[model samples]
Target: MENTSTRSTSRPSATRVFVARLVGTGVFDPLGDAVGKVHDVVVLLAHRGQPRAVGLVIEVAGRRRVFLPLSRVTAINPGQVITTGLVNIRRFEQRAVETLVFSELLDRVVTMRDGSGQVSVRDVAIEKDRNRDWKVTRLFVQRASSGPLGLRRGETFIVRPDDVTGLAGSLGPQSAAALLATMEDLKPADLAGVLADLPLARQVEVAAELEDARLADVVEELSDDEAVALISALDAARAADVLDAMQPDDAADLVAELPTAKADVLLDLMQPDEAEDVRRLLTYDGYTAGGLMTTEPIILPPEATVATFLAQARKAETAPALAAVAFVCRPPLETPAGRFLGMVHLQRALRERPQQPLGSILDKDLDVVLPDDSIGTVTRLLATYNLTALPVQDEAGRLLGAVSVDDVLDHLMPDDWREADDAVTDEMIERSANA
Candidate 1:
């Protein structure tokens, strides 16, 4: 979205506002009731262009922080701010192209454009551009002291952002820590995009900072090459832990991308239970039903009650596609479940009495695919039946995992689908339409 956070560059120009002064300022709604305090200013930083102030991070009641898009702000006066009162409650997330001014740029040391010595940044000034965009235009800096025992305070001056170097370079751990805080609200796919935009060193740093489970989710959304590179960058113990946290099918796919020896080493390091499932998946051809299916689909005995099924489906960890249908089998409820019976769609279960058995509402007529079935076959079966997930069974009628439509689409899309230009164009189109 286009951010108009600063006052318009009009006939009477507004004063050059130093972002440091805005922190801790009280933010109020249209009715003059206090809502929150400004904690930080978010800016869109560009390598060769002016950095635009996009929004303010405001700390509300309960100490929760939310992003206040510049478009929502009505006025920015000394010691106080006013908003349109309509605010999104979602937590603030820093996009890949953006940075937090206070957390990243303050106290940064930069070299002067001329042959003069280096200076440390004290604060930055932002103003509305000719195009009405709020941009960082000047820097407040202090030259290094050259007096006896460094007792004298260094001279300070206001200089253009272009008057110094090193401002755009990495800011070390502080940058990564702030970036991680902003990333907490991002989805795995979006987080992967953010990681992809970083330099290799920064990518590794951020990946290392993530918890194993979160790292696994993000890794699954990355391209094979990127996934391998990221995994390789981690220490063996942590890498195996992340792989263990990943879904079996996804873990298998990533493992297959690694060198044989490295893959073997990682698999050995994984928990036996998790490693077994991934190993089984690795044996299947990438295009087949066994390869694309997640081994953790919801499986229950034929006698499971509607209430029981509903509870299982409602778990926070249950994937929507996998939860849409539950498989009914004989004695062994786990995959390679014994004597596969019919399946029960969630819709069918919802209409039945809580005490009713799943078997009584079984969808027996639905056809199933085998482990060796082709991707095209799996796709056609799902489309033909309009199913979110399709069961895959063996000749002996034993149930294996089910192939989800999402997994099928993942394979069907191009290798670089995440970085596709078409997606970028579509997003731009959407933003323009919203604007």
Candidate 2:
């Protein structure tokens, strides 16, 4: 729900309070009997804008941390939190959709933009809305220096949500839709990071703002579970659009993870031609050549000249690996490919003869892979040919698609690759950034 309450431009210096400021404060029951110390702040991740504080984690007798839902709370102040007569003594287990301010965000590393410096989060300020729900508004960051045999703390400064680049920083209550407009320039990986760092509801809101192509790019970089979660958050039509925009093989891989009924619905919503490609890929074992190959390759007729191939290659400059080869076939490209002639490697074209006939320079002794070839077999064939791309064919000799090196590595790399976008070498990021 949108918070329509009047709010300050930022957390007022006079009344700004932090999660750290509340911990250790005595919690009093409605009858005024002291019960325990405020152990932590529990926030609901499903808020409309920024997540709101829903309750306090109190350390009662026996060192048990119990849930005290905000709905049961009576009063909250800096020194102590006074609860209503009702309190659930059951131990609290953090839910997938909840966040513990102290455990998750505080002391985390964040880059502050105004100074272009990275600092550690020292504390965070939370404020109340008209409905009395508490929402996080600002981050307090500080650097630490080593003192003589001791840890010396640096001065902490406030960085409102507005100040952090690509983050939903806010000075006050902001419309989720408004926050999305500011995210246009962010890369999918950057967008994913921002989404991951935001609350669940805000993640869905930001996702809703992205175009299908943009969201597909982001989804490709997310883990399966995370991708499924995000896709599920979207409306059915939008989710289907996003799946359609992704590489067919990748789309099928993800679709296979979804419950069958849901997967079928998405496939049904997709364009018939696109859905057919995914359906074909779904039939291949995930570790086979067909499983990893993308259905959208640059295909050219056998009579097409090298210049024609060059034009197609130029269109794929952003993804150089995709230009590995131009599949050549007879007219009316379709099942059985009308006679699989061969391919023209982008690098094999001599600069002196840009107009050379592509058919005349067909990749000689071509090593084609069958649909069910094992990844190891595909890898060996690719290595033996010194190829950056290899063609996958059906038994009938149709040029199905080409498998780029990146597609192969995507499956072999460590599971955490998508989570470490910033881990790229500066040169790689710089080239991609400028390109």
Candidate 3:
């Protein structure tokens, strides 16, 4: 390896290393004894300038991880890293400001400085400065083929960081087929944990490949900050589509975190009915029943048969809590219905004849809460009734929406429930990649 930076007389030429190839390479001590293996390269991204490589995340014995600061690095060899014998065994925790080069930078999309178009980052080359510090200076990128059939491959080349436009900003589109394949067996909640472990750039890449419905489920499982960041990274059209796919209350919650102008833009781009539902949910304080209720709960007219309610409740799209009962209303069956009548539990429906009118056996005595009611009131009512969901009504006795137990739990749980790091393991990713 050779140094790409300017030569200096004060120190021997520094080594230029490609981060992707550096991972898994052995780290050796002065006496050439193996110490550990490199797992990732850490870099500090400044507001304006090339990112400086600060250190390496290495895996020692017992599957313990540790940080190896660049200052302790001595030399870069063909397939091994030379470091000072002194090593700290503390576990590595990625700070908010630090980025892992291989997991974050590789496969990122950036625009060429010459206006050639967008390119995907294949690898990044880092070299030591005159002071023996490492900094990312070269990007190995590939432009998408413009051929008639895309039969020809894109051109691949290396350029300085200044030669690209979007490397320092929010993430852009990239191919995520491989990464998605690695997650093929994961459920949405488990998949969300794996994604949370990834950097924002990788999250955006995977988001671009996921179907809107699946993406919506995964986003709902993320923390507020993580959800907002991932949603904001997608293009406007797709972002609105994803919002439309999400439940009204969840969509409203995410939009509430975005800037006012951006939120308005996305809501306008969404389907009219979907946007209206989310808009109504956003009007109430987050701690009120109105904010936690979903506008799409299963609703039926008084004349609807028990059979009809059963089919509606069985739809795969209906949320589990909301599907536990069917809300029977007057003339209009949609939300803000003509008049709130009663609810029919699925258990009761199963015990009655299919031809029986839902209203005939409905639980008119079911407890209800006003939209303006506090979350505490809603929680007490649900617990008091042992109900999975409770109806919200207006002063005129019109049904507005239904608040499910999941909605209350989402607010009551710790804010970082979805960020548990152990949800996905390094061994899982390695096996998936190899498979």
Q: Count the backbone clashes (under 3 Å) in each candidate.
A: 0, 4, 0
TM-scores for every candidate against the unseen true structure: 0.64, 0.58, 0.63
After TM-score superposition, the amount by which residue 311's alpha carbon in candidate 1 deviates from its true location, in angstroms, is 1.5
Q: Which candidate wins on lDDT?
A: 3
Question: Better model by TM-score, 1 or 2?
Answer: 1
Residues 332-412 of candidate 2: C-alpha lDDT, one tens digit per residue: 565335557887887786452877888898975886689889888887887788888887887777788778787787776
Q: Give candidate 1 regions above 4 Å deviation.
A: 1-175, 423-435
Clashing pairs in 2: 161-169, 161-170, 162-169, 162-170
lDDT of 1 by residue, 118-144 (tens): 767777787877666678888777766
Task: Specify the poorest-scoring 10-residue window by lDDT in model 3.
Answer: 1-10
> How large an RMSD does model 3 have?
11.0
lDDT of 3 by residue, 300-364 (tens): 98889999998998887898999899998886777878798899999999999999998899898
Q: How close is each model in CA RMSD to the real structure?
A: 11.6, 16.5, 11.0
Which is the better candidate, 2 or 3, if ranked by TM-score?
3
Candidate 1, residue 163: the lDDT equals 79
* Higher-TM-score candidate of 1 and 3: 1
